[model samples]
Target: MIPAQFDYVAPGTVADAVAALIDGGEDAKVLAGGQSLIPVLRLRLSYPSLLVDLRKIDELRGVREDGAELVIGAMTRHADVISDPLVRQHAALLAEAAATVADPAVRHRGTFGGSLAHADPAGDLPAVAVALGAQLVAEGPGGRRSIAAADFFQDYLQTALAPDEVLVEVRLPKLQGRWGVAYEKFSRTAQAWAIVGVAAAVRRDNGAIAEARIGLTNMGSTPVRAGAVEAALAGASAEAGTIAEAAAHAADGTHAPSDLSGGSDYREHLARVLTRRAVTTAAGL
Candidate 1:
């Protein structure tokens, strides 16, 4: 389907982009890699009056270190995230999950910030971001501000970003200590959206699990932390039984969608099964 005609502007600077957004008002949509927006446009699900293209905004397009965190420019592509040495060493969960987003063609064009801003609950990166407690940086006509990953996503296809705001970068705190990470996904096909996915980060101390974080994908309206399971895994033995016990609560707080992919109960079942797999792998047991 052809999309409705829309005005397009490629801004050279963040400030210029903000100005364009403010001028375009409620009918403006920001374009990163156009991985999400383009599809919505083609389907006529969205009809923006103006498309503010940020491709020319060079500042928002790389990965760099800032003190104790890695600041990833929102425009950084999934392919770049997958291959970046810093990402692989410091935020391996993100790199691993990015590898599962669509295929090589889409990865080369999809942007990290765009994925987060698009706020698709099934998108692999959001679950990883929430699991790692990353932060999102947004720039708007008012000014710049930081939003925690937990708070950035509100609902399906919805985010906290104001109409005039543009996500500029993402800041992921280094996983201090010897943390093991894993992302487990269940899909019908290699590149299909996850029916249920789990992202796990386990920090081991001595012979016990010191800390564990779990993020659930496609189990709710947004990528949600498996808080009950996370709480349960703390101080628990790293044994398979113990991990399975904790993962049993993976669907406790989720409102899993019932769709052609699978029913709600089936997704909940996959959540527990995949969570156990992800946590066990992350715990290195």
Candidate 2:
């Protein structure tokens, strides 16, 4: 299917891009990696009057450490993230999740900030961002503003981004100490979107679970934090039984959809089983 006709503009500067977006008004869609948008355009889901491309913006294309936090540019490729030692060493959970996003080909083209801004609940990065407590940096006509991951996602296929805004970067808190992390994605096939996925970061102090951060994918209209499990396991012994006990509430407050992959009950069950696996794996016992 061919897309509706639209003008394309590749801006070399963030300010220029933002101005273009503001000028283009509600009819402009920013293009980063184009993995998601191109398909949407091809299928005519979105018919923006103009497409703003950010690929050539040098400042928006790398992974780096800023003291205790890691900042990833909006155009940073997933493949680059999978290989960056800075990301691999300090925030390994992100790298692990990136490896599971689609296959090698898609990873080579997908961008971290792009995926997050797209706000697809089934996409791995959104859940990972929530699990890691990352902040999204969006730039608009006024200037840059930071948004917490919890506040960034609004609802089904929607985000808090304004029409004139473009996500410039993502900031992740550095993982230190005895943090054990894992991303368990439950999809029917390789490169398939997760029917229900979990990204967990668990820190152990002595034999007890010190703290845990868990994020749920495809369990609701947006990626959700597993606050029930986090609150349940804190200070408890890091064991399968304790984790499993908390895991029972995996789908609490979620609005999972019934689709070709699974029904609502099936997703809820998958949420439970996979939450246990993810928590156990992240606890490393």
Candidate closest to the true structure, highest lDDT: 1
Model 2 lDDT tens row, 108-220: 89899999989998999999999899999999989999999999999877999998998999999999889988998999998899999999889999999999999999999
User: Which regions of candidate 1 deviate over 4 angstroms?
Assistant: none
Point to the candidate with the largest TM-score.
1
Question: Distance (Å) between predicted and true CA of 99, model 2?
Answer: 0.7
lDDT of 1 by residue, 1-285 (tens): 999999999999999999999999999999999988898999999999999999999999999999899999999999999999999989999998999999899999999999999988888999999999999999988889999999999999999999999999999999889899999999999989999999999999987899998999999999999999999999988898999899999999799999999999999999999999999999998
- Clashes (N, CA, C under 3 Å) per candidate: 0, 0
- The whole-model C-alpha lDDT of candidate 2 against the native structure comes to 0.91
Stretches off by above 4 angstroms in model 2 are: none
User: Each prediction's TM-score against the native?
Assistant: 0.98, 0.98
The local distance difference test score of each candidate is 0.94, 0.91
- What is the TM-score of candidate 1? 0.98
